[model samples]
Target: MVSSFRHHRRGFFSTLLLLLAVAGCATFVSNISVDVIRHPSNPSSSLPAFHEAPAFRNGDECSSSSATGRVDIVMTLDANYLRGTMAAILSILQHTSCPKSVTFHFLAARPEPEVLANICTAFPYLDF
Candidate 1:
């Protein structure tokens, strides 16, 4: 019974990883900050409002430059799930030893300027 449970858990985790990988990867996004102006668009790609997350800084023990120990994370920038994405990124920054070392790469089906603006506002110091 214990082995069966373990097998099911492993399968569930593997499926989740595969789903994340299938979302597609993206290149580094430039630093572009502007107010998110909502325009009439399809619901799937429509921009959502979000409050800015506090800028996360590295600890005293870590390198001053963000590039010293960088970690790249890739995710789909779907407006429908943008809030969840923000939450996930915020959670990571809050838990990591050197939040400055983390970078984000976002993939979107269509060009979404508002998405970039929103992210830039939400995470001003983010390397994305």
Candidate 2:
């Protein structure tokens, strides 16, 4: 019985490793241009506007201030995950003790002006 269990465990690990390798080898291609539409701000909108932290105002000289207690968040944005991304940003801002201390860096696959415009519209006070 122990030998049988060991064999099954080995097979399971092998399958898991195979899946990991396949997933690692998979390539994602974005052929379509992402269209970003800025949703009009509603007073009742669930997402709150996050304020910019005062520590980031020194124009890249503020790295020293970051040691005090600032957090940096980087995310890749695309049309495919817009809603979920928005939700996540909202959740982060809403739940954080110091929303202003968070800096967001968004990396988009393509140069989408509308995406940046929409992000600015959504989080006008965000320090990007």
Q: Residue pairs in steric clash, candidate 1?
A: 29-128
**In candidate 2, residue 5 scores what lDDT?**
100
Cα lDDT, all candidates: 0.77, 0.65
RMSD (Å) per prediction: 15.1, 12.6
Stretches of model 2 off by over 4 angstroms after superposition: 1-67
TM-score of each: 0.58, 0.49
Question: How many angstroms is residue 54 displaced in model 1 relative to the true structure, after the best TM-score fit?
Answer: 1.4
Clashes of each: 1, 0
Q: Supply candidate 2's per-residue lDDT for 108.
A: 89
Q: What's the C-alpha lDDT at position 99 in model 1?
A: 88
Top candidate, metric lDDT:
1
